[model samples]
Target chain A: MARRQAASAGTSANEAAPPPEKRRRVRIKPEERYREFVSKAVELFAEVGFDAGTRELAQRLDVTQPLLYRYFPSKGDLISAVYKEIYLDRWKPGWSGMIEDESEPLRTRLQHFYEDYTETIFTPEWLRIYMFAGLRGVDINARYVVNVETDLLMPMARAVRRELGLDPDAPIRPEEVELFWTLHGGIFYYGVRKVVYGFACPIGKEQMIANAVAAFLDGAASVMRGFAAEDASAPTAPSTRRRSPGSRR
Target chain B: MARRQAASAGTSANEAAPPPEKRRRVRIKPEERYREFVSKAVELFAEVGFDAGTRELAQRLDVTQPLLYRYFPSKGDLISAVYKEIYLDRWKPGWSGMIEDESEPLRTRLQHFYEDYTETIFTPEWLRIYMFAGLRGVDINARYVVNVETDLLMPMARAVRRELGLDPDAPIRPEEVELFWTLHGGIFYYGVRKVVYGFACPIGKEQMIANAVAAFLDGAASVMRGFAAEDASAPTAPSTRRRSPGSRR
Candidate 1:
């Protein structure tokens, strides 16, 4: 997508780099060169799909394939580096702490967390690379999904429980996780519309996040209560753990 | 994505097609051949991506380039057929009727509409092709986004207004449309996780749709009322028209 170019295209440093022999003589730092490889890999992978060969990547970086290989032993290693650079590295360490911060109201915490969270994940390269990695059926998607579940969605589910004055220690149900996903997924779809689908999000990200969090908080209590009520009546219900009665016709 | 193959890799009909010369002599029906071309194109485009050439597609179908061209004058025409077959043709006409059916409670209508809608759109092929096209910067995604807004999201927004006992014709604010998108996008993200990212959705589609609809409906009233209050207090506020104060920190 041309929008992706807007993010990584600002740097002409690679294009202006000295010839391979001259750069070798100048002796770039190994760690800086490694970081350069990862960032440039993000741009290249975002521009072309993940199927791009290292030969193409090295050419674009103005470095020899051997030099690229020196940093990343293989394509898979390079891709993992890209995933860390784009997805994992961009995640704010303060997010989970924000979600569980009891001093703030749930709405304020959620709104602020998402507004800040979207700021990191909402870029063109991040969105495109994530989609490209998923489309290629890489483990990057699955791994990120788990991180979101454990670090983000599950913690928010507990936050919702505590916010509603329900027992925070009560085992979080699959239905509860599903409920949080509606809010998380809804906000994510805004990013997809803006970055992936190249559609206008009309509402700016701040307003969109606020509207989503407000709507979700409004509906969450009763839905959770519905789950609680169902659990109370049939403590041993086989299907209760797996599916919500509300989902049925 | 392997899940995509699960949907389209069913029949060996193409694999067993007669030799091209024999097939030409056998004289396949024009409409039947056109339909075959479209379905096969979907499978191939979903597998390799939209970058596939006419020659490769014809070879996959066990037909000559000339014969394939007879059905679709150009590659774009063929791609258009795939879009129509996968996207437009899959939309059920009765969805809007279901959404507006006041005899049913708004939650009931929404839960039912989404359950049925997700069934139609949540396939692996549909999910992958849409992402692939969007990644390639095609108009298919833009067109589908509009269709979702005008045909689906706007109607649901209006439905939310009607459900909340507001003026159904109350000139739907962008905030209201975005509120509907939170629900719509949440459900759509479930599909993305399941189909595009190849992750387990845990809850079934029916439950996911139900949970999303319930949450959106739960919060929608106050959110809409908040909009109504803002509009009445400041009829001509320029900033009010563009951004929701709820979105502000």
Candidate 2:
């Protein structure tokens, strides 16, 4: 599987250190060093799979294993730290400046989210870490995936609720979220299976994303349609006008 | 990860052949020994993983590893045979038979098909083997997942197109099939993730599936609305459908 091979290839590809030219006068901070080391370790562990060797990590870092533990406490701690640094930190709005567009609809903004997410948030390292997390089962990896996936949905949900004027916490049914995640999951898996694992999906990435977006729009519209259908019996959401079901469906 | 642990645990749990009544003998033609071995191997592999030890296989069969391989030349040969035996003959029908009722709407029938697919195809051994296939980056695992996922969608797509009186391969600017797979990816990943690395998904399986279905419906509806609006005004789906007007804030 290219994803499995990608587990290792992407590791060194995304080394934690600043490039040589940029580092000429840079003095790295202690916590920053720890984050870098931890992120690197996460990449390595994810790449190497669960039984990541400390010795290999040291070799990768070009530092002694003893020095490695000083920042984090143990191999387990380092793995956990990397898990948080890369995957956990990934869910938050890293591109705050990017998502601040006020005029665009949530659906429009989501396209950008998908782009950045596919590029930065859902990289091979992220997936590799995820694979290990799944393997570790009750370990930090699983916790990390669940937590990140949850957080990944948060910003989008907030955006949709804001734009659509729907319930933010109003018992958003499971299927509602499933639709969102399904588009997300299909894109993610198809990407991995294609780019990472080198599988042939019948469609290209643009088509895949279009399909996902279509599905998401369709799914979101249904909720409104269903809500509007209910509203005929009990009118609510007076802010927006409802078209006839025949007109909509 | 629970998926990984479950794989290991699943094997350990079935370390022994079933007791007297459990191993009920069925008459088999001598010509079908290969077939019989393949079925048994699939159950074992899915229950455990592709990397499952020969020792375990022997244990499950109440035979020694050497004796088990007599039918096949080597471990590789045996597993390959097992894969073909079970998947080639059986996997295509994962949930094919579950949705014979044509009266059901596309959404309901799709959900029904998914639920049945989950029950029949996602056997414990299937999880183990598939997960192992992913981790090892095995070609077969990746191939089967994409193939099976696509195959599962065939019935759903045909049903939808038939309802709309659209051609099976009609180019109606990418209909609900994309939405189906997009949502499917999410649900499948969540379930696969759960099985591989145990997690109490915030919602139950049924709820999760429902959520996905809703999303797909909503998204597809949105796309359809867009399609109808476009088709009404123009002969082709507007190029703008491919690109959201702009990104969300």
Candidate 3:
């Protein structure tokens, strides 16, 4: 038959397909494997919240518990590693990258930043740790907090200045940054309170996200305009979702 | 001598302020005692959060464990009662007082609403229970979340219409009430997040609170203005907290 003839032409039927080449042609580096482990931990954190089982976490990774022990010595170490690799590393770099993109206008970039902030913080894995650190008696205010220079606030300020063509040394004042965060907080806190207290949020989730972005830009723009002593003289009311083509530079 | 003379004229110095005259003020309605017990629970909820000792709660209240049990069957019940009283009763009512003040612009009233949202949700008792509910695995998506009606969204919409004096039903929609919750959410979540997982927040607590509020108002105004589609525009950029002069109205 045709099948027999094809098999005979390719290789002997009794001979196996050379045992899948005995090994991977491209090997996984230790860094890659370690990243894989931490990535799995993110899902585990979401599943059980911050203080759930490490043994279960290891089980989820398809490795024996001792094998996990080989990489991490303590629960604290594992959690800290999870915080560093999965949450901080993933978000911080992306934030800086967006801010550094000089081609995009400040308003658009700000919208992009809000999109990132809302998405990253609200997602289950990060949100789990975000909520857990407080009540569990963790000291989020220690030297570790001060060391976090890469936070969104500073990056945001830098981006604002960069957009305005200000010198690097001439970043916006700390008060301006503070103002931005304060307004930013109202929306953020509302979303959070709903989550923690188990309130069925009435609004559509998509609108909520879009509003967070749009409102943030509006407020921050107000702040920046106020900085220059520019008054928004209104013959006008503003729209929530649609931007005016005339307002764009 | 003069300071001591006033007390000696009417009462002994040793008399502890005559305990507010033991006459009961209100009728003993159903759940009155339950309400009193919950008031104490709110005090405790504010102090140690929801999960600490019931025996300690009894000791603090100077009652027997059995007596405490007679009023409420369990600690969770006591905690739930506190939530029902504090969060449930006044959420809608607070707006009724503010929105009816027709002299003020809707935007000013909206700002006032945001401020009250912060005070109510961020305080000790409510914040503690809010967390407890989350930790206890209460469903956030439950229908009973907050239990306020869609009527709340109406005031702002009406305010926007009257301020610009638009048609009762304009072609373009006014701001959705959904924006308000999202605005509240983004701010509240940061507070909880700071407590729960300070590791993820790049900014300090004080700064986060301030910035988050600014973000909320900015977002709210932005969404509102965007939706209103006003021919004239409010200054979008403000670098400082410029108090709205009309907020005094």
Candidate 4:
């Protein structure tokens, strides 16, 4: 009875093993597979845009269509994952601290921060994907802009005020935000012109950043002095109450 | 014989008239048709982007695919036509003269110029197509940027210098270019954020432009003063010789 059972099991194993080499698949762990899919998908999306078909992506990934579906159920899901990785995950933790460190000259801090920041976000992939999202009318670009304005530009403006010997805790002015956006947008446009639009900037990136930072610092100091002069000249009315304790009237 | 000929002609005419309504085609002049095609194509391209299929555009125009092909040999040709119409054709000839008119205060000149300029290019269609062309890696955007810098910004920088009692014919400084770009780019980003990216700005368009222009003029004057101070303090090196007759060393 034992010999008969062993013979039956051996026959079933042989049937299962027939043409096994052709049917075998590489066994990637599920977590590893999901990450690989996102990485490859980002490249493909950045190359051809988010509208590229899954068949092309699957072909690029050298995987079956079903395999891609197993990782990301829909194209939108994949795009959301891509946005998270590109916008959210890529931001460095120490960037805010770098800008706020007060020990370094404002020009050096700005120049260094932009050099590092641009290195992370100013690639063709980042700029193209950003424009792609904007053109597609996705809110991702707007949300990212808000994040930059609030987290980066706002703090940088306060830092600029501090560096210029103004009260850092003063209520931020619209002109201050606009000025920061000018410097930030000017530098960002350098990337847009170079990476997205493929224009050759007459100046290299480092020199451009240095020049922009120097001009910004100089301009900010002058603007602040003008503000002080205006305050001194204006009649103090009841409406002239300061919004912040440390704010200049 | 005449009666028989008339009878036969009437019989043929009667036969031709049976489906006359269905067979008749609108007799649009070729020039009119070409203009109509271009106008419609711009709207469609601006709406859906350059990657939109020709068939879809033809459908939108209520014409056949062959008719569109008759007007434009290829999609690329159609896009070129769109670029020419949007970027080149829309520019007003009087804009440079407006900026160069130093009789008016520099603030008024800049304000008027930008208002007119933004009205021409800040529509959803123009901004969208501009971004689309940029993302598609087309030279339209780069060419447009160059045109704007040359026609608008270079002259504006000289105007600012003139307003500050500096020589107008001086060789343009990189700082001047970058500063003008900051102001120009800051305003442009306002349109991009509001119209293209659909972000709500804290201020209205007119207010934003007013703030940006005021900040720009003030910062520019400040920057010029700093340059003058630096020039006064620097050693009279041979390399510091003026490149232009109006330039200061």
Candidate 5:
């Protein structure tokens, strides 16, 4: 009787109490919530990797575990979403056009393109997730490599051939692909060294990209000249020549 | 009485119950046992990573946990031994002499040196352990990078300068170091792609190294010629120039 009297006294004192609207759950669109979960999950996965439990993710998202599961059924499904977002969705369509833009000097175009590309991908989130995915033995890295080869490397090879006065339609050589990968991998390694391994890179990103592009173009030109010289000195039998690897396109 | 009779019957069947000498523990020198433990530990760590427990290691070594601790004292101590063996002990003293040998062509020398170096390091065991060490936030990878830069990259820069008819004792440009790293990192990435990521490289090791070295030499030569041409035309003030990072050496 005393407790009831005290509760009544409290209610009487706060006769101007607000309605229950403040305690109600806020409604959000499903698509918007899904996007929010993916963005937040990318950060959490990058920070703690796939080993992070769903409880941790839920805490980071400020949501209940059941709410997180409502969006992503499992941790692997969430990681798959992250892979798609990062590797597949993040590629700007204009990059291909920029690479093939013959109006600009190839060196300037390459410099601008890589600077922009690295700006997008050289972040701690991207690099760490990439390493984590590779460590987990996922096919995402290999798939991304194949995408890079087909989308970027092949076009770059054709451009190099065009600059060298070789037939643009001619098949690309294995050596050519390897040389391009050397430059590309070198730049990527700089990111790995700095972002992943936490090493200090003495030079800025633009400077490194510029140096790599200069070296690649110059070296490729010299190699092409050597090939031209060899062809002039002794015309080889075309029948014995091996097919170029780039002919598949 | 029945148990006693059974025991006596078993002893009688064995006739002599072979002397205790036949069942005695085999004695091994402490130092030999320590070396044996380290060797076995390296294999286990390489296969399973530094997370392998002391009990696991002991089981692999066919010894008791107490016996394993007698040599390593702790897991960290065993990992330290592994770092020493892989990074420091595996380096061949003759590699420095090979790089300095001017009698052979630079291409041939680079090809031979990388071939030998890769043979030592490109194994699955070494590559996985290296990645594991890096992921574990150990100083081993950083220490190894410094060793490579000082011992290998610096000497290579000098050789490139000499080849370009520049002063061999002159400061190595950041560009020079980057170019060398491009070649080195590219080659290293090839090993990573194959061993760690389980990707198949279309080209063999020898071909890839030859292509990279050839590209590097040609590129460095062309870049040097460009610098010379610019200096001849402009005659810029040398005092205003920024020093190369390698000048610290």
Candidate 6:
């Protein structure tokens, strides 16, 4: 009886209420709204890291909490979307082809590849968020590092050997990868100095990339041969040195 | 009247209260307590970053808020102390002399220097806290970078030129410093890989350091000469390239 009375009273109140005003609210498509939410989420997470609350995200997006959740079911889902957008989506498919293209000199190919790669990656959002995620012990960085090692660093190591007319079939050694890492890590550290530490790199991007390429190329062959000689002389080297992939030869 | 009544009541209650039990707590010296706070602060900052709270730090230390404040004055002071403990105090007074020591080969010196340096710095606390602070836009990284460049990198660049029979007094170009940075940054990234990203560096530290030293020495002369040629050939080069310190020569 009480529920019925309350419903009846509420209905009477609604009937007696004044008519709402006509408003000029813009209607957005669902697709547009979803894209907007994602872009805004990237900005938010990039600024505050993974701990950014949905309430703050909603506030930034000018959307309701339910609407934000409607787009992304959970924080983990949203972060996955972010990783895909920033890392996977921005990754150019042609990079591997560029690195392996036999027509171009290896130095030229590497310079072009890193110029393109750094352009894609050396932003505040990508750099800071990566460090943040890595520090947080998130596996995304580990996964990305593996991808880089398998696809980029290892292939480049082979390319160095081929360019130097060394036995291209020789197994990749851990030291070879470390040499390549010096080049890659040095380049990445330039970005870290600029973006993370806010220090000026002093050289323009093209010139810095050129310097790193030249330096790596100048030394890579010797480093590889040095490692081979070391491996040959060591009585127990094969058992001790960790092998890179395709080490069976 | 109300305040007086409450004060009298509190005094009466205290007078009527039973004697407190004798406690057996270990008394720590003030200096010891201060050291304990800084060590814990380093661990806390390394794990959770700069946003970690004093309340939590106090709880972790098993001390009162006032006690922490007495030792640290503020969060910034505690962090400064931590920075001093980790970076400044741990920096060896012998390193500059070691690098400048003409008695030993540059490679041998670098290997020894890095072995000693990594021993001092390759901790989870040192590595993670560095990344955290760098990402936080703290100037400590910038300060440290400058210190490294001045006390270590620039000197190493000069040493490289000296070893390679290049004009020992020739002005260190930006490219020379950058070449050395590749070596330094490469070694640092090894620590980052192991400590921060939890990736295994397959080679033993001694061998890896030796590889890096050999690789850097192999190309340092050519890279330096290549820059000299580039500088000589460019019509408008003097204005374009960034000059490192002592570029006036």
Chain B: TM-scores of all predictions: 0.83, 0.65, 0.54, 0.81, 0.80, 0.80
Candidate 3 chain B: 10-residue stretch with minimal lDDT: B240-249
Candidate 5 lDDT, A82-192, residue by residue in tens = 888888788887887788789987888788889888998998788778877776777878878877777777778888777877766655555566667878888888887
The CAPRI classification for model 2 reads as acceptable
True-contact fraction per candidate equals 0.72, 0.47, 0.39, 0.31, 0.35, 0.46
**Residue by residue across A16-63, what tens digits does model 3's lDDT show?**
673454432344576775776788877777555665677787667655
Better of 1 and 2 by lDDT: 1
- Report the candidate with higher lDDT, 4 versus 6: 6
Which residue pairs show backbone clashes in model 4?
none
Kindly list the interface RMSD, in angstroms, of each predicted candidate in the order they appear: 2.9, 6.9, 14.2, 11.8, 9.5, 9.3
C-alpha lDDT (0 to 100) for residue A141 of candidate 1 = 89
Task: Please rank every candidate by TM-score, starting with the best.
Answer: 1, 6, 4, 5, 2, 3
Give lDDT tens digits, candidate 2, residues A1-249: 111344334447565643344322345688887867876787776566656677788768766567776786666677667766665576655544344355675555666657777776446677766765665454665665555445555545545666576665553433344445666677777666664455655555555665576466646665544543445565555433333221212
Q: DockQ for all models, in order?
A: 0.46, 0.29, 0.16, 0.15, 0.18, 0.22
Tens-digit lDDT string for candidate 2 (B1-249): 222244333335555633344544555565576666667787777654565677777667665567666787777787777666545655545465444357666667767777766665555566555555566565886677556545665555555556555454534343344445666677777776567666545555665666567556545554545544555566554333443211122
The TM-scores, one per candidate, come to 0.84, 0.65, 0.60, 0.77, 0.77, 0.82
lDDT of 4 by residue, B1-249 (tens): 012244334455544553334433567899998888889889988887877878888767677678777877777788889888888889898999999997888777887888888888788889998988887766778888887788888899888877788767756665566557767877888888888888876655565566566655655676665555555566354123222211221
Q: What are the runs in model 3 whose C-alpha is more than 4 Å off?
A: A1-89, A117-119, A141-150, A161-171, A186-211, A228-249, B1-40, B43-50, B62-67, B89-92, B115-117, B139-153, B167-175, B186-249
Model 1 root mean square deviation, Cα atoms: 7.4
Each model's lDDT? 0.80, 0.59, 0.53, 0.73, 0.72, 0.76
What lDDT score is found at residue B103 in candidate 2?
Answer: 69
> What are the per-residue Cα lDDT tens digits for candidate 6 across A1-249?
011244233445545554354544566898999889888888888877777788889868766667777777777788878877787887787877788788988877898899899998899888877887788887777788777776888889878778877665666777777767777888888888888799976676677777667766776667776566666666364545653221221
